[model samples]
Target chain A: MATTEAARPIAVATTPHRRTRWRHVLTGSVVPRVILIVSCLVFLAPFYWMVVSALKTNTELAQFPPSLIPGAWAFNNFPDAINYIPFGLYTFNSLVITVGATIGAVLSNTLVAYGFSRIQWPGRNALFYLCVATIFLPYPVILVALFDIFGRLPSFGIQGAKSWVDTFLPLIVPAFFGNPFYIFLMRQFMLGIPKELSDAAKVDGASELQTFWRVILPLTRPAVIVVLILAAVAAWNEFLLPLLYLQSNDKYPLAVGLIFFTSEHDVSYNLLMAASTLIVLPVVIIFLVAQRFFIEGITVGGVKG
Target chain B: MTAAATSVKPRSVGRFRLGTLERRNLKWGLLFISPWAFGFIALGVFPILYTFFLSLTRYTGFRSPTLIGFNNYTTMWNDPDFWKAAYNTLYYTVLAVPIGVVVAMLLAIAMNQKVREVAIYRAIFYLPSILPVFAISFVFVVLLNPGYGLVNLLLTTAGLPSPNWLGDPAYTKLALVMIAQLGAGQWALVFLAGLRGIPIELYESAEIDGAGAFRRFRSITLPLMTPVILYDIIIGLSFGLQVFTSAYILTGGATRGGAGPDNSLLTYVFYLYQQAFQFGSMGYAAALSVVLFLASVILAMAVFRWARGWVFYGGEEA
Candidate 1:
């Protein structure tokens, strides 16, 4: 910031061509502006095509030189798509897992973060390193073992030996444990809170938990919001887990459900795109709503994105 | 409150006993992270160790896993499909990671410019990436559908022959590379974040030295952004090696269990999934994952070694 201004006067004096180029481009530069506009359209075209194709009738969709815009918007494509596939049940199952796991994740990650950050304890650094190390442990390795464990998570009322396969428990239950990335993100965010707030709370006879619950969590709503959206989006888009455990279509998430829809309704581009759009809606909306926080989380959260 | 009355400081006391307050904090700390601690023991530690053990055993889902020695590893070594999957994974990673990073870096630089309403453009660029990975895969399946697909239509109109994307073995991985590049916005944002971090003053100082934009970029922007670029490359490589859903969805894995034409899109994780669940070869899948984990470590070590002098850090050189 100091540099932008300090350098600006010098830049104007030193490079008249550069200043003119900036000014010219700001007004109208055919090449750069064209590139910018074209790239914008390129990014946007897929979405436009998805929406347009979703609304097209099969006849219109079959056209050789496809109409840029659908001649007739089949609004019923959504309903038809939902009816054609078991999207509603799949969506409901996905919702349950997303909400259940998100709630579990937020609570677990925040609580664990508070422990790691606010209250410095013996072996905390070592324990924290242990948590961070899990970030590198590829999901596929643990997945082979997790399947067996989940297979053993005793069936409550169902008959025969327990299997987490074809059930929602495996998908929803792990969020309660704590995700390494979320724990790390929330921990970093919590560490930024001044020590004096917790100190003052301690002096007033508030317990550590009380200080954390009342003082820290509230102050870190932004981080919570970030973690919530990240976790929820992750749950929504998770294909592999839902594909793994949820054997039946009744238990499939949107991600898995959409794939099933595509294969079942092959060549029905309209319906497939419609279903795809619906699956993606929640994630795009959440990111739009909390754009800054989402980006901030990524910046701090590092790569598990 | 009364803990301060104890005439002791942790630093001052060389090897003193644990203070009451320290013990209390420890208790609460343990209590706070108890969920993760239990979970790690149950889930993290158990699963990792069990996976290693399972790799050496014949564990189909229904039957009890029998100790099979190094059979699973040896089987994978001999399997033709395993080699194919490994080769496909390597091909995808080598192709995708570099292109993805460069495209994202360029996009970030362009988006970093002082333009009006650049936020809207940034948001637009980022939307495709943030959209569920499978959704983009679904969309691309439609957009790239050989004959009647929009991509082919455009190509033919321009008098360019459009290859059968998901159909031909030759084009399947290339098609995936294109799909992967389209969603480079996530890393682009990371690069944008890095680009924004570069102080404007550095450019001005360089500009005062009569450096051209290209020279300034090379001298100032490129060096500063190396760390983020390296990070972006590493993340891209990991994801590239693990590529699955795009191939699975695009090829319609449900109807046909094959990845793509002749399994060209069969990545490491994809093959692992197929082996464990579809083929019920859980032990074999475990071995594949063990190889993958080792590969990831080796890859990171290679990149770190490669980055020794190249990746610039601010305070270190100064």
Candidate 2:
């Protein structure tokens, strides 16, 4: 801030006082526009570097100070990186796994959350508390238990088939069962809705399912979208689950794929950056488009703190 | 004619009484919620039960189970590393949660300072939050790199010695703690929303009473903000305890078997991962997970109970 002022003084002196004040405000404040620009640079530099490095030759990558900008972006790096691994196969695998998991999570979580929120039933609090309690058990503790159960027996009656844990079922199946986090979010959003509407629907002889489908689902679109987005992002970015369950490299998600890529290579920074860039591109695009709802979902999803 | 027409109204198709329809609706509602009911039994109940059962056994992922009740838990009680992981996690929790919350609140206050391009600043801070953990980890790895990294460069230029960040055992956990602060923009935005929800009249009355900024904040804003703070702390603790991606990636995967440099960064989850997946100690891993789960539950319950005294719902009087 002080440096920006020091850099341009004559213009400040010659300009109208209002203009000078405005300049000072934008350029010299705590969160000055300049600071914002620099932070954005910091925020964006890695992705930019990744793109540039992905384009650079192996020779250019090791150069001192690293090329801030590539001389000639080796577009071939994209194909080359993909070729090094079963990139196409992995991409398809990730999409299938992520999509299936997301759909399953949304359906199950929403239904469960609706039950917890609006539907009165026996053992409701105890059941809901049990769901909430599940959030605390970190993946490590459950991994062994889950493996024990799924690893031995055919998962979900897929017996005589290859072991279920080695395949994609375990990754996607839990989502359909609903996650505790998504349930909390759904229930919170449901509270914002007027109960009178549901009552009116009930008075009209609409069954609970009909009301949920025709009314609650439509009204809770924002929450639903946010949940779906979160689920997709989580599933897409998941490493541990796939790492545990997936034996074949072809079954890896992008997170695992990028890691495997780095592990296989001889620490080629440029190639690693390229792969990381590809790994994050879909998430960045999706988030940028849906940022508003995403933020809303988070704030509203949280316990109003 | 209008009165007569208005008075006469009974649809023969429907039962107008409440009791009959109410019972029917209750049954239907339960039926509609059956998917969740089934899920609770299958996904929720069974896994928890299975975990408890597994904890008392000695089953690896590859092997058949053998009963060894309470041995895994008892062994963990004696293990110094378990204590280390707990201490490290608690160290992180103590340092990160309060500091993160305070910084977020301060940042939100700064952001609400009637400035132009608030949205832009908000987005700039938020960028890190949305980035994949690996990307942030990679950038920090470069930024925190000893000699050539930009942070060190700036420190040296300013006539300060640059600390070895990720490499030093002393600083590894601290470095992880610092990295947690970077993506604080998301939390700041959350705080900003919370601050906005606060009615302006509270501030107005405080000002009218000649309460200065600090006093106003102390007397009014802080109390009103307790619920949100409680919320943030609970969420942050759970997430922070499970800190893995940064450590896992930075330490070159779990094949290294633990967090780097004398296990300075070996959080419980990291240790649990090593046991279950890397070492193939499924039973031990399940025990560790169950214990960790119990710990988190205790923390969560503590927060909720503490909140009853401090957190003011809008309708509740102080």
Query: What TM-score does prediction 1 earn?
Result: 0.92
lDDT of 1 at A79: 93
Q: Give Cα distance to truth, residue A138, candidate 1, Å.
A: 2.5
Report per-candidate DockQ. Answer: 0.54, 0.26
Measured with C-alpha atoms, the lDDT of residue A257 in candidate 2 is 75
Q: Docking quality tier of candidate 1? A: medium
Candidates' C-alpha lDDT: 0.80, 0.72
- The numbered model that scores best in DockQ is 1
Candidate 1 per-residue lDDT, tens place, A153-194, comes to: 776743232566677888888899898889999999899999
i-RMSD per candidate, Å: 2.8, 6.7
True contacts kept of 1: 0.57
Which candidate wins on TM-score? 1
Estimate, for each residue in B225-290, the C-alpha lDDT of model 2 and write its tens digit: 887888788878787777877777777674345588888888777888788877888888888888
After TM-score superposition, the amount by which residue A15's alpha carbon in candidate 1 deviates from its true location, in angstroms, is: 10
